[model samples]
Target: MAPEQGTGSRSGCGGKGRGRGKHLPGACWDTLWGDHSPPHFPSGQVVKLELLEQVQAQLRDVLDKAMEEAAQSYLQPHRKDPPTQHPSPPHSSGLLEVEHFRTFYHIFIAMLCVFILSTVAVDVINQGSLDLDFDLFIFAFGCLPTVLATWLVMFLYTLLVPYKALQLWAGSYHTVRFPRLFTAILLEALLACHAAVLGYYPIYTVIQHQLPAASRFIVILKQVSFLMKSHSFLLEAVPGIIHAKPPDGEMKLPALSTYLYFLFSPATDQLPSPRTPYVRWKYVAQNFAKFLGCLFYSYFILECLCIPVFTNMSKQPFSIKTLVLSIFNATLPGTFLLLLSFFAFLQCWLNAFAEMLRFADRTFYKDWWNSTSFATYYRTWNVVVHDWLCYYVYQDLFWLFRGRSRVAAMLSVFIMSAIVHEYVITLCFGFFYPVNCSPSLPSSEVSAGIQVCLYCQEWYAQIHCPLEQKTFWGLVTPRSWSCRS
Candidate 1:
C-alpha cells in the first residue's frame, strides 16, 4: 500500500511539472484567446509587449516629474512652466488721461481764438491796413502785455494743471466724480473744430492756389528761414537784441546795463580816448580766414554760372546726370556760403566777447573748448543759446523733478533741449516730410529715427523706476517687427 501511494505522489508531481512547462511565462493572453487564435498567431508575444508598454509609461511619468522639478528650481517665481505676465499697476505720475489732455487742448484753443479774433477785428476795423506784431523784448509795451499775460497763464496751466488733474483722476479712495473731466473733453473738441474753421477760412484762398510741389518748397524755405532766424546763434545781434530789454521805470539798472545802454544809445558822449586796446593776432587771423572762405564761396558760385554744360542741362529733359549737376551746383556753393556767413556773422555780432572768440576759434584749436565746429561751437561761442536752453529746458526740469533724482532731471532737460533744438530747425527748414524739398526723395527714415530715439530717451528718463535697466533696454532697442516693417 506504501509503494502504491509513493508511485501516485511521484506521478502527480511529474504531471504538475509538465502542465507548468506547457504554460509560457507570457501566455496568459494566449490562454484567454486560444480558441480565437488563428494559424501563425503569436498571442503570447503580444501580451508580453502590452505588459512592457505599461511598465514604460509608468517609468516615463516618474522621469518627467523629476525633470520638471529641476527646471522649476532655476526659474523665477513668476516664470515657472507657462510663465506669468502679471500686469503692473499704472504709474501714479506717468500718464495723463484722455480727458486731461482734452481740457488743455480746449483752454489753449480758447486763448488762441481770442488772439485771432482780436487781431482780425483790429485789421478789419482799420480797413485791412491795420497790423499787429509781437516782440519778446518789449513785453511791457503795446497790446503785447495783455496778450502775453493771458497766454502765459494759458501756457503755465497747460503744463501744470493737466498734471494735477491727472493726479486727482488716478487717485484711489479720494476720487471725486469725473463728470467735469468728460465735460471738458467735449468742450475742447468743439473749440478745436471751431478754431480750425476760423483759421482755415482766412488762409484757404492762398493755400488752395498753391500746388503741392510749390507748397512743399514754400514750407522748406520757410523752415530754413525759421532755423536761421530762431535757432542759429552765430548771429549774436539777434540774441543780444533778444536779451537787451530797456529797464523798467521801477527797477534799478545794473552798472553793466547802464554802460551798455550808453554805448549802444544814439546819444553822443564827450570823447576821452583814454585807452586803446591791444590788437589780437588771433582775431586778425580769423577775419582773414573768413574773408578767404567768402572769396572761395563767391568764386565757386560764379564758376557754377561759368559751366555752360550744367546751365544747358538744366533746360533739357531730366536725367540722373542733369539732376546730379543741378543739385551739386545748388548745394555746394550754398553750403560754402552758409559756412562763410556763419563765420562772418560771428565776428560782426560777437564784438563783446572778441578775446574769448579769438581764443576759441584760433589760439585753442582743441575741439572741446573751440566754438567754430558744430553744435558745441554754438553753445561755447555764443553762450546766449546755451543760456536759453539752460533757462528753459534745464532749469524747468530741475524745478520739476530735481527732488526725485538729479541724474534723471539732467537727462530729461538735456533731451528736451535737444528735441526743441531739432524741432526749431525742422520748423525753420521744412526738411522732415517728403517733398518738403524733393518729390523724388524717399521719406527721411534717418531723420525720423533720430527724432524717435531722442524722444524715447527723454521719455525713458522721465518715467523709469529705480534700478529698472530692463525698462531702459525695452525703450531703446527696436523690436524685430519694428525693423522689418
Candidate 2:
C-alpha cells in the first residue's frame, strides 16, 4: 500500500462502523484519519495510525463501561437533591415595644434587675472590698449621699408626682398645689437617712467581733425588737380611744385597763379587735386575747411555711443589719397596709371623734382639727408644731404689725413647714452627698450637712459604701425601717 493508505488502514477503528452518534463522511475521514491518524499537521507526514486507532478504540470502550456503571450506581429510583430545603423562617429576636414592655414586662424586668443587682451586691460585700473597718466608715458617710439621692429621686418619681396627679384626676379638690417640690424630695432623703441609725449597733458589733451567725434568732430579735418598746397596749389603745369617742353608742370605747394590760400580757386578749374597738374591759380583754391567739397562729403558720426554707438556705450573718433587713423584706408587702391603717382607720377615727365633739358643741371647723382646705389642713392636722409656727412665727409677724393676718399666718405656716421639713431632709441629704472637701470637714458637720443638702451624687460608687451595704443587708435581715414606714 501507499504510505498514506497504509497509515489510514492501520488507524481505522472498526472500519468507521455505524454507532449512536453522527456518521463520519468519507471526505472527513480521509482528512482527519486517512493520512493523519494521530491528528497530524496539514503538512504531509506519515504517523503511527494503527497504534493510535487501537488506543482510541480501547479508551472509548472503557469510558462507555465506566459511564454505564456510574449511572446504575447513582441514578436510583428514590434518589433526589436534598429537597432544596428552604431555610427555616428566621427566628424571632423577642424584641418588645415600649408600650408592650411597660404594660406586660416592666415589673418582671425590674424584679429580675433587683435580683441580679442583689446578687452582685452580695458578691462585692463577701469579696471584702476595702476591708471591714473601712467598710463601716463608707457605710456611715460615703454611702449615705448616694442612698439619699436615690431615695429622693424614687420618692419624687413614685410618690409626690403620682399622688398629685391622682388627686387632680380624681377632681375632689378644685386646684392643684405645687409648692415646695424641692422640699418634698428633701423630706424623702431625711427619711432614708434615719435608716443609718440602725447601723450603730451593727458597727459596734463588727468592732467588738460580735457579728453572730444569722441562724441565731436571739441576737436577731434583740436587734430587731429594739424599736418595740415595752408598752401598755391599753395605754396606746386608750389615747386613741379616749381621744376617739365612736359615732355610734353601740360602739362604746374599749376598756382602757384591759387594753393596757394586754399590751404586757402574753395572753391572746392583749390586742385590739377590728370588729369591736368599742367594747368594755371584759369583752375587750377576751377579744384581745383571741386576736393575739390568732396572730400567734398566723405567725406560726407563716413560719411553718417560710422560716424552715429561709433558715435552712440562708447564708447570711445574723447581725443587727441582717435582722433589720429581714424585717424590711417581711414588712415590705404590708407597707401600704400599715399606711392605710394609719390614715384610714387611725386618722379617720381620730378626726371623726374630733368632729363629733364639735357637733356636740354645735360648732363647725372651729374644733382644733377641722381645716377648710389643703393649706389649712397642714396647719391644723399637726397642731402642736403648728402652735409653734403660730406663736413663734405667724404671731410674731402679726405682732410686728399689730394684728392677725390670715395671709401672714398662711405664709408663715407654709414657709415654716417647708423650712423645717427642708432642714431635716437637707441635713440627711448633705450626709449622703458631701459638698466641701477639706481637712476642716468635721464628722458632725458632715452628718449635719447631709441632713440638710438633700441631694446625692449619681456616680458615687456603691461598692465600699454604707447605704449600699445596708440595702443588701436589709434583704437578709429581720426588720428594715424604710422611708414610708
Candidate 3:
C-alpha cells in the first residue's frame, strides 16, 4: 500500500513538471521549483534588494519634488516680490546691485555742480556776465507737439487694429477650414498698412523735408520703436490666442487696460496680466528730477567735452593726423555719452513713467558696464528690448529650424538688431550712411570679433595708461588712434 501511494505522488509531481516545461524552459522551471538545497538568500542579496527598493523610493520622491518646482518656476517667469525703497546690503546683494552706484552717484552730482560753476565762470570770463546757452537743449525738443500728434495716431492704430484682428482670427480659426491662411493674409495686410502710414511716411517726411537732427531723431526713433512694439504685441499675443482652446461660445479680446499698460511699459513683450505697484507721488517726483538731471548731464557733456573737440576737428584739414586726433578726443565723451544714454533712458526715464503708472517691474537694464564681452554687453545693455528679441525673434527662429541651426538663428537676430539700429541712425541723421554696417555685414562674425578686439584694446588702454598719458597719446598724437576704421 505504501509503495502504491509513493508511485502516485511521483506521477503527480512528474505531470506538474511537464506542464511547467511547456510554458517555460527546463532551467527556468528548475530554478523556480526544482529539487535543490533548502532555499536560502545570502545576506548580501537581502541587503542589495532592500537598498534597491530604498533607492527607487528616493528617486520617486526626488522626481516628484523636481516636477513641482519646475511647474512653479514655469508659472512665474518674472519675480513676484514688490519693489523696495532700501538698497540691499552690500554683502547680501547679488552680483549686480543698485547700491553699487552710490559712489558714482555722488561723483556725478559733484561733476554736475562743477560743470554748472564752470559754465557760469566761463560766461562771466568771456562775456563779463552770466549768459547761459540753453538754446541747443531747447532746440533738441522743439518738435514736441508734432511728436505728440504723431504718437497719438500710432497709438490709435496699434490699440484698435491688432487686438480686433486677433479676436476675429481666434473666433474663426477652429470652425473655419482655411482659417490660418485667411488670418495670415489679413494680418499681413494690416501690417502693410501700418508700415506705410506709420513707418514709411514718417521716414519719407523726415528725409524729404530735411528735418533738423533732433527733430528727425524724435520722429524716426519713435516711429521705429512704436512699430517694433506693435509688431511684438501682435506677434506674441496672436499665436497664443490661435493655439489656445476656445472658451464655450463667444470670442473675447484682452482687457483694454492690459493693452494700454503694454504700450507704456518698458517691456516689449505683452503680458495678459502685469504687476501693478502702488503709485507713490514722491517716487515719481524723484524719478522725474533724476531724469531732468540726466538730461542736464548729457547737455553738459555735449557742450563741454564734445562740442569743442568736434568743432575744432571739423575746421582742421581731413588727414590721418586730424582723424587720429579726433578719435582720441572722442574717447572720453564717447564713454560718457554711452553711460549717460544708458542711465537716462533705462533708469531715469523708464522709472519716471513706471512710477507714474504704478508699473512694478523696474529692471529695464542690467549692469552692462561690468560685461567683459560684446555678446554679454548686448544681452545686458537693454533688457526690455533683449527680452523681446530673444523670445520673439531668436527663439522663434530656433523653433522654425527645429533647434538645429543655432548659429543661423543667432545671426538672424543680430542682423535684425543691426538693421533697426542702422535705420535709427540713418533716418535720424537724414543720410543713407550705414553707421552700423560693419556689425550688419554678411561676414558679421568677423566684424564682431574685430569689435571685441577693439573694445578690449580700448578697455586695456583706459585702465593701464594714466589719464595724462591717455590724453597726450589719444588727444595729441596723430599715430595713437583708437576708433574702429
List TM-scores for all candidates, in order: 0.26, 0.21, 0.69
lDDT of 2 by residue, 152-216 (tens): 44333332332333333323221236434543563465335424433243334333443322212
List model 3 lDDT by residue over 1-52, tens digit each: 2212445334323542223222233344354577753345566765764564
Residue 59 displacement (Å), model 2: 99
Worst 10-residue lDDT window for candidate 3 reads 87-96
Pairs that collide, model 3:
none
Any idea what lDDT model 2 has? 0.35
Candidate with better TM-score, 1 vs 3: 3
lDDT of 1 by residue, 1-485 (tens): 22124453243224322222222222432443465643343667556645654664567578878888888886846533432432222221111124774574466446445545665686788776655442311221234333334334333433343333333332311233664575467447534643443223213422443323223233333332222222222122223322433343222212333333322321122121122123344644655664554444434333333233333432344345544445544453344334334444443223223332221222111122233334454355434345545554566567787467767766675566556554433333222211222222111233223332223222223232223354656544422112211
Using TM-score as the yardstick, the better of models 1 and 2 is 1
lDDT of each: 0.37, 0.35, 0.64
In terms of lDDT, model 1 sits at 0.37
Question: For every candidate structure, what is the RMSD over all alpha carbons to the true structure, in angstroms?
Answer: 31.7, 33.4, 13.5
Candidate 3 segments exceeding 4 Å error: 1-99, 175-177, 244-251, 271-277, 432-485
